[model samples]
Target: MKIVEQSGKETGQGRGRALWAAVAVIAIAAAGVVGGKIALKSKVNELVAERGGKAGAVEVDFLGRIHLRDVTLPLGGRSNARIAAIDGRPKILFLNGTLEMTGLDIELPTARILVPHASVEDANLDPATLTELISRKSAAPLAKRIDRFAAKRVSATEVAITQAIAGSEQKTVYRQVNLTDIANGSVARYSADGASFEFAMAIPDGAGGSKQEVMTGSIGQMTGQDFDAAYMARLYTEKAGPDDKEPRPLYGPLSAKAIAFSNGQARFAYDEMRSSGFSMRMPAEPLLETLEKLTSVTNPEELEPEERRAFFGRLLSLADIIGKGDMEMLGLKIDAPAKAGEAEGEKVKLAVDRMALQLDGRRLDAALHGVSMGEGGDYVKFSEASMTGFSWDSTLEALKKMAGLDEQQLETFPFTTLLPEFGTFRVAGIDVNLPNPDTGADSTGTEGYADETGETDALAAEGLMPDAEQEAGADQQTNQPVTSMEKPAAAVPERIRFTLKNYELALTKPFNGIPTDIRFSYEDLSVPVPAKAQDETSVQLRKLGFDELVVSSNIQAAWDEPSQNLAIKDISVSGKDVGSFSVSGLMGGFTKDFFSGDPAMAQVALLGLTAREMKLEIEDKGGMAKGIKFYADQNGMTEDQARGMLTMMAAAVLQQLAADQPKLQGPVDALSRFIAKPGTFTLTVRSKAETGIGAFDLIAASENPMLLLDKVDLEATAQ
Candidate 1:
């Protein structure tokens, strides 16, 4: 549009001058009108393109010094509403102008249902009167309205703030909204950090009010319903949905699909990561509550009686939850408290601490110790996990949570209880003080005691002997007073007394799941059995009162998962170490005991069978005297069948002895001599098993003869 220009001063009413004046005024007015529309439209498009977002037909109208009359952003209409107001004034200097709209209605029906009410403080169009563009252009009103409406439509679905500068007066709220009907929604807000652009996220935690949820994701991604950029891009542009404006279900089920975050810390990579495990240390209180739920522990008062057992077990397992290699990672270190007199030795060093993880193609390996391993072929594998001096107590605390116990339960269940369950005696060395069976240096140590009773001694079976009575009487007489006693109390005299010879035992293994190959051995391990009938002085009684330990060869049988079998092994032991091995950690049960009543039901369960129910068979072939054999006929059988059938129940033999001697009735007090003392039977068997706990094996006879097997440390060793 060509226009003429003229100053009011050189004026003449001539046709040309009049025409020039009129042209100038009209041209300036027209420029003002067109410029306003062009500028506003340009800003809106810039916003959408810059953010890589989508929108619909936009219209903005203005009036007064700084008031907006109508602004129509394409918000999906809630039954059709209209542009409300825009009233922020651009600090215009001189010229006064207004473009007032008399009527306005038509809510946005696309990105959001924005009923915009905006007021620019002072809007003017004069060249010299440009106002401060506070918002660049106000879109908050439209967004806020859209958000409010969205919340009502769906309880689960709403515009969540992908990023927000909260805790401030001028907090910017960035949100993501999904408009299935509109075929699109916006990644909206003034998120300078591009946080709102995240397509996927994982919230660490969420609670009822003021939930502090961390949105972890990446930029330029579309999250929710498995939808991403490529998918949403097509859907939005094509406007494909059940109707023209709605996004089709085909485009939904959208997920961020491994979105990126923090520049490059996170990036979308085809949803390959099955799981990216991350550990978070929460407040200790919450962790305690978690444990309390699993067991019956609530308070300290209830710990010893009920919660003491399971608490320790759960704690041990929980210690493993860091995946066996993260003690250092968790910044846990074991610090032994300084003893009163002892100075610390060289600091203990950590040997191995390694943790490895693999998900999809991503791998995270960390260790405080050197390690080597083959590459993960199909799945990730970690080896060599050892955390030295880890906080046993902290681990127990964690176990409570892992065990699903509440916080209160854990408080009662401390980690100390596990030590007692391991059944380690404070004393180790003791010597057996009995006369030697052999005259020479007592090389084989029959000197330790009577050692064994030869089955041929018929008089020994009568249980009457002056020597036995002398030993019993001597032990009962006070050593210091040197008094002769005509009579001792019947009960007191009945209890046998065996002076403790030095015995030794030391154990080095974890409590609970102590390694099976683990061994507890000592050079001077000695334990006296019931010497005389004095039960009060007997070691067995003392043991029973405490650890309830039994003496015998333990026929141990267990399953080895790796070998896939019922493995057979044996442990020969007799000790005065009696203590309970409960699965509970002292602190575990206390939490539930108070709140939920009684949780003692989950005790150590039943004490398993000991070796007593276990038995052994020995087979050895011997030819009878040739002359006697020629005259008499014993059941004649081949060596092979004889060997095979020789297998017989040891219990049956014990029963036979009990039947023969009526006095040997109740429980068959120790094996008696009446049962046929095994004659030369060599036993060949693949297994040794016990019927119950606290019972094991005792070899009554040897292969050469029915002679007693003493010092049967007939040792077995690993091949």
Candidate 2:
């Protein structure tokens, strides 16, 4: 009986000890849970305080879930942000979570943006690294920290932004915006739908005054692909080193559809627009800094003249950051109603089928297709126009320089320096149609110039007619005043038409704002002319039996820098069923001073110019015969008589010319033969002096034609 009692006591003692140990373990776990909650809340408050923010009611649950309410944060400068509530579910120690934010609002000095709801799914975040990145106090590479960020999706609903610019308010609203597959602080895709904006401001009225302008615009959809949010953020927040040359793309491709804008005076619309490959050549930090400086100024107008100029120069420097990009727009149209005092049906209309621009480094290439302007029967249209290899480097530099000039200096600024360099410019399939100048309804017509006899006044009043002797001769032959030679007004056309197949200009080399190697040409150009046109040239063309002028011309010229030589390779103009004329010349003594961008300097340099050699050729297809017939009709004589009279007159003039210098005798004889027979004629002129004739000598010879023969060697032939 004694052994049994001892065993039962030992078993009871062991059970009690086991129960106490279990109670102790439960107490320890309970204390740890309370401690973790308190610690998480404290940390939250601490971080908010560190960023100059305040947080109200922070709560943490046992599962590491967090909730915060009434958050207010400073967003740098004069900007502040507020959040109504934030909820986060942490998968690992608050380092990653699904976060939702509600009632978010950001207020700037003159703007405010509001978001009703925003959310991020499966977001991986590091608070410490993010803090460092935002502060920009660390020297670490942006990619390093940005790479640590990732999220499956981020979205916002019903975002609104309102801004006040120049005392005018503007508001923009977006219905739905979202980003998907966000990783490395960048987004694989982004989209926004149903965006609209309205604004009002005062703009220059182009009459030394300002006018109130109201504008409204809308976009049905906007989308971006592969947007580098992190790099862009870094650019705005961090200063780049001098050696940062690697181009960083801001986005892969972006597009907008159903875009439209309208002001009180005009409406603009486009079916779609797209852009891609926009990058930064230099660092973006400078641009950011400049913007900051500009915005920080309380009253920019109060600044000194020099200070204002410096600020403008800094502003212009921002363009240097652009590296390369391309943009295209389709189906663009603009319309403006006729203004007061304008004629009916005179509304302005412009349409473009497509337009595109590409920027690579400092070069820009642009093209326009199917462009038309004006309304009613008066319009200009072109199938295509393009410009390639337009470099903005010099243009930007010139603008910056101008920006730094004071008012006094600007008055005398060398504007020629602002001319930009270009590779090639071409326009094809151009058509222009307009009412005849003479018959136009406007009072600027030729009615006031008519004489009492219903005949147009003599062209001699406009210095268009020949000398008095020739005028008298023509009048005597026709037995009437020269003014009566003009066709009656009833014979004029109602409208004029002009068309061109192509026009092109190529500047292979440009130096000091002048083309050193260039080729300019136009093909298949045609313009109709009325018989009674006021211009002497048009009258002559009509008298030559041409109802329409159809011609093509080309000019190819170049300058040799090393040798100081200017060569005009070809300057040719050809008219259909008329004739063709060409001129080629070589000159020396051209120097850089000729293009020094100063008018005075250029004029001074022109005095030192020298002419070396020149060649002129003319081929008479049928123009010569038409001219002889017209002269015979005007002079009341036969064609043969007219041709003989012209030949004798030319010979008589040549005999006088040969009196001073015998070198011109051969050329004069050849010219007489060409006139009599209506055949091809060629003339060549070479400088007699080894150094070529100076410009001063040429100017002097202009007063005494005989003097020019002494300075040039002449060759002429008729075929």
Candidate 3:
């Protein structure tokens, strides 16, 4: 009985002690849980504050993962203009080094965006530590800091946006925006699908009224990839070391499909657009210096006028970024009414299968294929056209050096002022169709244009002959010329005078330069000559029935003072169906002192000096003989009559030459024989002595015209 009583007492005491121990452990664990929650809440609040958001606006919910709701972000220190109702479900995977945010939503009164899912991979930096790194002052470049932050890859899928402006009834909606491996990847890809945009604006019409313009468009899909953008941006924007040869190509590829735009009246549709290998070269020393100066200024307005000019000049210098790339568009079409209100006249339709442009440093090439345009109730077509070697680098460099551009002067300089200084350029296969002004009855010049020979008969009746009374009346009317009594219209000077002034300013300082050759040539150029008065020179030329006309020129000019020489190497005008002619010459004995005076006076003096030593040779080949015969035939003249007319005209010209110089009578007679048959003719003239402008005046005033030619050399040949 005594042993049983003792055992029961000990068991009860042991149970009581065990119960107390368990209670103590539970209390300690509950206190620790509360403290941990408080610390997490404090940390989240600190983070929100650092990101410029109010802690009270953020709501935290822990349902296995972290969730935030109803966060407000101030805009430009304006609490009223703020981003409202931001919500997200974010889970931090510490072991995997990732932050996955799902169902993220952002809202504003005018605009709203929702991102279904976003994830940041390789997010190894702690939030607090990242905040400190960002907040701390450092001497490193902003590019470098950004590079460090971009070490992690961020991806977002299926982002949609809707926007509505306050004063506009239009709404814009964009859907399915996806970004993958945005920061660090071989190619960071961004894409969006099914985007609709609307715009409305009022444009001023020439007459005081306003025209309302509305535009609407849709993007079926757009995809863009920046090939190693983060890396290349760091390399190009950041300062380079002495050993760096050149920055690698900073390039990307882009593609878009099914873009359609319309402005109520006209519509444009493109099936697809692609741009590949777009690149930019890092600028040179001058451009770099300008960039550095720009960075030194916190406010652009603080810069002086000169500094601003210099900055802008340097910036314009870089506008030709010297990159190479290719771009292409497919299935482009344009449709519009040909006239303002006449849909029945002709609805214009233009279509092109493909258009492409390619650039390779200092060289450009472009091509278009399957082009067709509506013309005169039918479509004019072009299979393909291309051009190449269009560049302006060297000319721009020369202008820069000649202008003596200082850093300050370059800031606001307009580089287009130098456009007039560009060198030679060439283009091929350009087809231009000038709209005919006389498309109605005037184009046919007679009723029943479709009838055979009606136009020629009408022209013959109207233009070939005139009655004696009418001719007499016309002479009497012309004898008394009617002059306008109204005050002359004041000439409005062109706005381009300012640009010309800039060019003159560049030339204020003398620059000894090399020879330059500039020419522009086009092929298959055809233009119809309209009906003209009987006195026009081209009226006779058109009667020759030439099918087409081509105009081409080649000029080589040089000025050298030390060498005491000025030369025009060659100037030629050649055509396919028309005749060809050329003039070339040289002069010597011009010194530097001759050009040291006022430019205009110097030019006059130079011309005088050149006139003393000038030598010119003029050449012609079968130029006007065929045209003359064609005209005489069209005028119903016999072959013999045409021959007689040709001979009489030749004799008259030779007689005039004889009047100028009896010493050239033999040559003049020879030239007449040369024109009698289809042959080439050449004339050479050389000055005899040093003559000034007074000599030309004397020749002009001389009653004995042949005496002037006798003072110089003249030679003519026919073969």
Candidate 4:
């Protein structure tokens, strides 16, 4: 179908001529009143008539406003757009146009878009620049050209979109959209009022039916910036390998506020961003500094390899900025029904009533509530799970301490040095409850055990219990006579403090500029104890014991820079049920200066540690002796034989202590006296000279130890 062209001179009828005439008329008007508004309208109507209704009707109102109805504008032979109605004033002199349309629809071979209403105004754009930008084939060139163009104050309202895929349609909508000052730098913002999206997602439903998911959320506002083409490309574009090319950065910064979205089962939102006044400054200072330095060098690649590594090192330091913000979620859940081959009650469901995250300065906190199991018999659930007061500033600073080093130096630097300086990590509340395992018998195996291979505990027991003669022979070989079988000690309750109401760990940076003061504590801690059940695999939580088992440690150590020594002022570990213990020492001659030449060698030199005045105090409530006897009895020995074996072991240990320094005999006698008692005992051991004991001796007891009683200095007392 060809369109006829109308002009001052009669033109031939053809699609090309028709399009050219229409463009020429608009261009003339844009070029400043070549053909009057009336003439332009007539030409548009003429082209519409020539299209034989394929192009809808065009009319000119008395007020010189162009009116379009059911207008179909062809984009070559591939696609076209249908405008139900268009009413607006077109300004040619200012190269600006304002238009409003209703029922605007676009059609393509595989897709279609519909817009109920759209209004664009104050759009000042240069035609030639737009033509040049669109003509470019590559993104780099397109972005570069876009840098020269600017458009402002363009807004659209109520946009509806639909995408077709494999016989299904996915729909999305936006309530309002705006573009402000797009050019070298521009901002774009959009908003949606609890927009609803619907889609059919394929899932493993019992009947193989697609699941209908509806996501509803109010996208309050989202804003983004478009800088220059090169900048944006550098920030967002990624290229692969030999075929890849460096890209220019385009966008600047992007932010979203009060953003939320959720399908029926899961919900995600940032409700706190608005209500809690959340704001953050991303750590970018180090990166900015590095880039600023590079600006003086025409090409950063031209710099030396060492300089390049230094630049990269600086960039990584920016990651320590430590943002502060708050986030939250509501009604998040996951559900999966039992499959055909799965057992009953095998379905899984996990739900959380609410979850929240908060960051203030260097501290990070999180909270969870109404946490419950939806499937698998609800074994574990906690009404609340909260973790608060954790600081990262100290840790980051410790890491940054190595920032200025070269790549090789950094590789050898001990990153673990930063581990102990995490400032403080605290969790004030964690209350969890777990029920007994299921006990119903199944065809697979016994109740609760659920062994698929038909294996039973009796089979396992047979392998564990040896014949009576074999047991007797084992004891006889060791020359240890057993009067009676030793009842096994009860399993110690887990020390994890699962019902921990509060916990804390901290390593403080002293005012003296050295790592000092380490503190750890646990309060209101308890462990669950399970009772025997008919099914070996299942046990019911009969009671909670070990209550009020408070444990605390406050260790203070300092470096004497002049003497290159690490002085331990105090180190203690104490608990309510366990005896108190303390250790103090002077770790002399650390050789910190000797390793100053190389970081790698510095780590090695740290091993050259010598200590003096090492002291230890233990206040035991006769528990140590009982523990020793119990352990020996487990090895098939009588109570008397266990005590005799323990005495020899103690004497053997003292020999090693005396070998390091004979003066340790005093502490040796003190230990002996404490071991001989069956009541409360207090034992104290101190290094007689400046060199109290060797590190290896204290850590790994010595062999072939030499003991001398003349230089002993120790004390032990019993009550």
Candidate 5:
């Protein structure tokens, strides 16, 4: 009994001691809460004061959540900001926190922004760095500080911006915006929905006047991945000095969908646009300053000539500094309403399936696919077109240098320096159809009124003979004098249907802006024969049974800089149902001075050129027979008689040459035989001299054509 009583007493004492310990713990916790509140408030006040801000009531909860009301802060560089309330939970005392801001309004130097609500989750922010960034202080330091920043997500709702510029007000709005995985001064993903803006600017009207142009645009969705916010801030805020070797900042991939812009007269829209690998080395502030200066001028013509030149120099510099990037757009379209007196629904419509541009250092590339313009039967279309390896560095530098020169200096400038190097340019599968003025309808046929078999019923249909009555009226009109202040009716443009299967030009190895290597070719190029022949050559060609000109051509040439040799590998041209002509040759003594842009230097270089070897071949494909028949019809004689006369005439001319220089007798006889019977002909010329015939010697021989035979060996064949 005694042992149980003693145990009860000890248990009661233990319970009392436990209660006291609980009370002490409660007291310590209460003290800690009170002290934390004071410290948090004090820190907030200190930071607010440091930034030239007024702090309102600050409240701290037991969970270390702090709330501030009616806070006003200066946001650096003529900017002020106000927040109705800010609620946040501190992660590490009072230094960084997850923040929610409501009713935030900022007044900037030239703009005002309003945000209904914004939040940052798991944020780790440095107040000093934040203040410096907001105040437009040095960006280098802020960029460094960005490495220390951490934020999992940031989001805002219904953000709006308004700016007043040069008596014009511009507004922009975003329905919702979100930035996720923000850390180390970069954002993993950023997105915005339902964005729109209005822009107003002055544009020159060609008549020494300026007009206000207002444009409104909208974007359905905009998104970015892996955005480098810190780098962009540094780029915009810092000026690039001469010794600044910092690489261009990268801005990951960005895309926008359902983009549209409209002025009063026209509208432009695209289904989607994407950009990747965007970077820029140029400073933004200077460019923006120059643009602002230019935009502020209501009358651009009023600017001094020096100012204009300075602006041009700045533009050139900007072009030079543009770094590497690529952009692409799909389903691009433009529409404009038809003018008065036009048919109903006759509106301008243009569309492109895809357009892309890429810049890599000094090189630029561009491409367009599935392009079409106009509607219905009258339309222009091309399947694809591309240009690659266009380098503009040297060209831009030359222009920048010229931009600083006066008119007198510019007059003597070597304009050859402005030429840029080009690579391959190609366009394929082009087709065009337009309304023919004569027929007042779409004309797909290339032979005017001729049928598919190349037969015309009327002489006028062949474009050989005009209407007698119209010719008489034209003669009378020409004889009459102008008696009134009136102008004659403008001639209507000839409508033509054109189709090209492919066209390509490739150039490389430039010397003084001239391409040393060149390759140019076009295939299946078709154009309609004009309704009326305008010249004698055209009339003769039309008379040769050519209702349409369907041609294909190719040229390949190269120059060896070290050897000063120019080789024409092949220059060939062929016509459908006609014949083909090809020439191949090699020449020497083409120095760089030939392309020096100085006339005197070019003249000297030209005198030193030498001809090595040349070959000319012709393959007749019924065209020669057609030509013989045409001559017969013109002379009102039989085909055989016409052929004999033509051969005799050609032989007489060649015999005179052979008489002067007997070395040409063989070629002369061969040419005469070829003319008598229309067939394949080949002419070959080779320099007899070991070093080839000089151009200067050839020029001297031009006065006496027979002298050229002594310098070269010639051969001709008829088959």
Candidate 6:
């Protein structure tokens, strides 16, 4: 309606005309409100439909005001929307809306999770940009591209699909979603029926800082085809903004089915995973930074100069740990403290698998099978293990390269290169009867793994030694003899050393609460002795030698918790070159010196011995070892008349062993005088009986003289 007024300018009485014109203006404003309402109502209706709303309503408030009421946006449900703001802002303005969105509660799977609470103040949200990326990422082909080429190369079985759950304020196009902190908290749970996981996570108040959110409910199941890279390129290319023509590849595709994680941990399933070798210029990751720190955690330079060099070498060894290494079990168990319930790391297994690697040009191929990615992120138990095949081709090639030899020439060398430290591997017990590389027999060295087939044979011993020269005879004994007789049988050299193999040990008994059955082999050890009277006196050490050691020793013990008396039940031992000897003496009547001036006779002197492979178990249960036997001049003993004093000679030697002496007795006491004052040609120890005087073997089949080791200059080396 053309309602025109305000003719006050033409009216002479302007005040009166203005009043009439104001009334006209008010009348026109009332009608204009009706028209503005109609236009705004149409606008609101269009917006509701665009937002998937149905049966929406609009209302106009006082002057130039409009309100939307009970406006529902349909996601298969009904809701309301309200918005209010000034037509043209002069100073302050405000707009607010409350939404109660009921989620799609279909046959969703159930899950329980506890999420730590966190928050952030500034998020710098780019609703528009984020929306575009999200839209692209959620595309059936694009998201599928991420899902398809997701594993480097697509598997015939496995596929991934992602759909928009709750999109950003604007549509987004992403090559692959970098969920960032969201990815940190979110976990994927899926099965092998080509069903990808579709989950809805509660967005945190903010993305970073202390912000955290955990959702515990079934999101959805995805049974769609995976998108390929070509699809991703095509999808993004079509949606590409003004300058998106360059087509940047976001996250690189995976070359292997496994997801290689931080700290060198990896996880993968066998069938569903597709792997293709691809070079990844791994853009700097936080994990790499962390591992670098670990590599330098214990600085080699922290050690002393000489020690530092060795430490540095060991640290360098760890650099190629993924290539040339062995499995050194640090630990395995349930509820590992590190990483807690998260996936268990693959440190040891990877090393073992890498043990057989060879650098063929720049690429490395394992001579053995690659380690299987463990089923569960586990520690103690391995449900599945990788096995290796027999092929020494790489080893042969390495040898040929080094020596420039042909196959015929290489044949001259031993194919089995022995690791001196590792020794030789020989099967002893339960044999898997695996064919040998050379001998091709069950007797050949072979291994049996737990997961595969036949029962495993007992693990074999690893080291073997070359044959040694047998001791010629008692005459072969080293050192000078006192009476010039053949060497003592007890003085034979049978080298001994300790055997330390990994053996399952258990407590059998305790001698004085010290655990027994702590058996160990002692081989290739040497002991020495001295010549004596009657039977040769010697240190018998036939229980230690150069072969397999079998030791059984009982400690000084008692039935009660605390007891004074200590008795050794049995300390039996067996070795290839070792013999057994048992002896016992009462620690009675404390004396300053045993064979010196102040000495007491042992009431019970006992010792038993059995010669090598002989039934000669001889034992001597007899007289005390008098410090010295003297021959007095003519009838009785007078200091001046004694030309050769036996007691003095013996005491002199005994005093060297005994630090202190309280008394002296008999000829043994007299022998101390010579030792106390040296440079005297007194009675020397003899291996045989002298024409008028004598000394004899103490502990040997053939008596021999004692040569003191203290007198030898041990630093000598032959030219």
- Give lDDT per model, in order: 0.31, 0.80, 0.55, 0.54, 0.79, 0.28
lDDT of 4 at 673: 65
Best by lDDT: 2
Write the candidate numbers in order of decreasing TM-score: 5, 2, 3, 4, 1, 6
Q: Model 4 misses residue 482 by how many Å?
A: 23
Please give, for residues 16-112, the per-residue lDDT of candidate 1 as tens digits. 7789989999898677756775665566556544434343344544422333334433322343323344333222345333322322344322222
Candidate 4 residue runs with Cα over 4 Å from true position: 1-85, 90-98, 103-114, 120-157, 161-171, 175-190, 198-326, 330-426, 436-498, 503-522, 528-607, 612-719
Q: Per lDDT, what order, best first?
A: 2, 5, 3, 4, 1, 6
Q: Kindly list the per-residue Cα lDDT of model 2 for residues 1-719, writing each as its tens digit.
A: 88999999999999999999999988887788778767766767777777789888788887666799999989889899999999886546645678899999999989999999999897764446445544445566665567567788889987899999878899999878999998877889999987999998665665678788788999889899988877776676566776677677888899999989888567889999999758875554555777878877777567787787767666665766677899999999988765532334457799999999998877899999999996665778999999998886777777777765667998887676677788899999999876556644222222222322333334556766566687778778989854544433434444557899999999856675666889999998998766556666777887788878899999999988898988989999999888899999988888888777777887888888898999999999898788889999999999999988887888888889777667778987888888877779999999988778899888888898677776788899999
Query: On residues 616-700, what C-alpha lDDT tens digit does candidate 5 reach at each position?
Result: 9988888877878998998899988887887888888989988977888888888877777768889999998867889877788
The sequence of per-residue lDDT tens digits that candidate 4 reaches over residues 283-375 is: 233333455565556664555766765555555444433345565666655554446324344666666777778766667777777766633
Q: Compute the lDDT of residue 335 as modeled in candidate 6.
A: 20
lDDT of model 4 at position 366? 76
Pairwise lDDT winner, candidates 2 and 3: 2
Q: Ten consecutive residues with minimal summed lDDT in candidate 6? A: 609-618
Candidate 1 wrongly placed segments (more than 4 Å)? 1-35, 38-271, 274-645, 648-654, 657-719
lDDT of 3 by residue, 227-266 (tens): 6654455444643446544434555788889989877666
The RMSD of every model to the true structure, in order and in angstroms, is 24.1, 8.5, 11.2, 15.4, 7.0, 27.0
Candidate 6 local lDDT, 28-133, one digit each (tens): 9877767766755565556566666543346554443444444344333232322221121011123221111112111111221111111211222122222223
Best prediction by TM-score:
5
User: What is the C-alpha RMSD, rounded to one decimal, of candidate 3?
Assistant: 11.2
